[model samples]
Target: MEQPPVTPRSALHTRPKSQGCFLVGKSLKPVVAPIYKKNGIFYAEIFLNWSHIVGERYSRLCRPVRITGDKPNATLYVGASRAVAAEMFYSVPTLLERIHHYFGFQILESMRFVNDFSSPHMASTFSPKKEEAAPQNSEEADASWKGDDITYPPLREALMRFQSYMRKIK
Candidate 1:
C-alpha cells in the first residue's frame, strides 16, 4: 500500500476539530468593503434608513440613487421629476447640510439631480394599512361592563389600558 500525498482539501478535511477555521463578521469586511467603496457609500445602514436621513417632506419627492467619487465631498445622485427638479436644485445647499448632519460628517458636496419621468409616482395622500382588531374575549367583555359603571375618567382610562394590554398578550 502507498501513502497518499496530503492536499489542501484533504488537509482541511483531516484537520482536528480544535484547529478548524470559521469566519466572523469582520472577515466579510474585505468582500463588502470594495462594493461600498466603489459606490462611494460610507455605510449600508443609510440606505436602510433612507427615509430618516432625508426628512419626511423630501423623502418622496426625491431619492438618493448612488454616491460618486472617493472624496469626502462625493456627488450624490438624486432621482426626481422635472416638476420638482428646479425646486430641489435651489434647496441643494440645505439638503447637503442635512445629509452631512445625518452621517455626522461631510459625505456629499453636490447633488446630481436626474429627472426620471418613468419612476413610479409617490401618492400625495398616505393611508396606512389598518390593523385587524382583536376579537373580544369573555374577560374583555366583562371588563367593559365594569368600566361602563365607573364614570371616573382616570379609572376608565386605566381599565382601557389594562384591556389593551391583555388583548396584546392573548
Candidate 2:
C-alpha cells in the first residue's frame, strides 16, 4: 500500500496576528477592532451604552474618555469633575473589578480619572441645583456662597450672584 505524503507545518504560510479580518479594510480595523480583540468588548457600544459600564450615578459625574493601548493592563481614561474625581479615587479598585468582570477579562488594570472641570457636562453634574431654597435675604445668600463646590470660580460666582439678584427681584 502507498503512504500518503504528510504536509509539513513549516511550509504553510502563517498569517500575521496583527492582520485583521479580510472582510474589514485596514483603515477601519484600528477604529473598530481594538474594542473587541483587545478588551473583548463591543466597540461602538462602549460609547453608546456608557451608562451601563459605570452606572447611572457616575455616568453623569464622569465619562470614559478613551482606552489606551492593547495590553491586558490598558489604561482607561475617565473624564470627571474635580468634585467627583475624589470619590472615584477610593472606588478605583471596585470600579476596575466591575469593569474586568463586565468584559470577562482584566482588560483595564487601572483607571485614570482626570479632573476636567472645564467639561460643560461635568459642571452640570457637580453644580448645586437651582431648586435649592432661595436665600431669605442678600446677607444669607452672600454668606452661603462658598467656593468649595465651585467648578469654575469666576463663572460659578457670577452665576451665583445672578441667581441671588434674581431672587431679590422676585
Candidate 3:
C-alpha cells in the first residue's frame, strides 16, 4: 500500500505554546485602548485625563474641569487661577493640539479657561503659610461688547484672564 501524505497545519489550528506568541497589550489594543489615555486612566470623565494630555508641569497648576459642545466641535473648560491661566496662555495652541491627539480625533475645537482661585488647591497642593493679599486690579475688566457682557463674578474674572492670555499671546 502507498504511504499517505501528510498536510501542514492550517491557521485554524491553535498556535503552539513554544512559539513565543501569546496575547499581549498590543494584541488587545482594540479592547484596552478605550480604557487608557495619554495622561491617566479613562473614567466617565474624559477631562479627568487632562494631566496626561497637558503634561506634568502644566497639570500641576491647572486642571481640566469639563468639556462642552457637539462631537467634533467640542470645547474644553479648564480651571485655574488668573496667574496660572496667563502662564498657560502661550501653551494653549500646543495643548489644544495635544488634546486633539489624545482623543485620536478632532473632537475639541478650543479651550475656555475658568479662573477659579477660590480654593487654595488651585494655586498649589499645599495651603498658603499666611493670608495673601489679592491683587487690586482684579476688579478691572475691559468694556464688554454687545454679546460679551458678563454678569457673574467668576465669569468676569475668567474673561479678564482670557484677555490677558490673548495679550500675552500677541
Native-vs-model 2 lDDT?
0.73
True-vs-predicted CA distance for residue 64, candidate 1, Å:
0.8
In candidate 3, stretches whose alpha carbon ends up further than 4 angstroms from where it belongs are: 1-45, 118-170
Please, what are the lDDT tens digits per residue for candidate 2 over residues 1-170? Answer: 99989878866777656754566466777886755675555434556777787687767777877878765767878887776788778988977787767767666667898877655465655676668788998779778866568798898889878877777886
CA error at residue 86 for candidate 1, angstroms: 1.4
Please provide, for model 1 over 82-138, each residue's C-alpha lDDT reduced to its tens digit, 9 standing for 90 to 100.
777888889899887887898788876788889765333534323366897664786
Each prediction's TM-score versus the true structure: 0.50, 0.48, 0.45
Tens-place lDDT digits, model 3, residues 120-169: 35545445688765545533322332225678888878877887776577
Pitting candidate 1 against candidate 3, the one with the higher lDDT is 1
Model 2, C-alpha of 140: deviation from truth (Å):
24
Among residues 3 or more apart in sequence or in different chains, the pairs in candidate 3 whose N, CA or C atoms overlap within 3 Å are 39-52
Report the C-alpha displacement of residue 83, candidate 2, in angstroms.
1.7
Worst 10 residues of 1 by lDDT: 118-127
* RMSD (CA, angstroms), candidate 1: 13.2
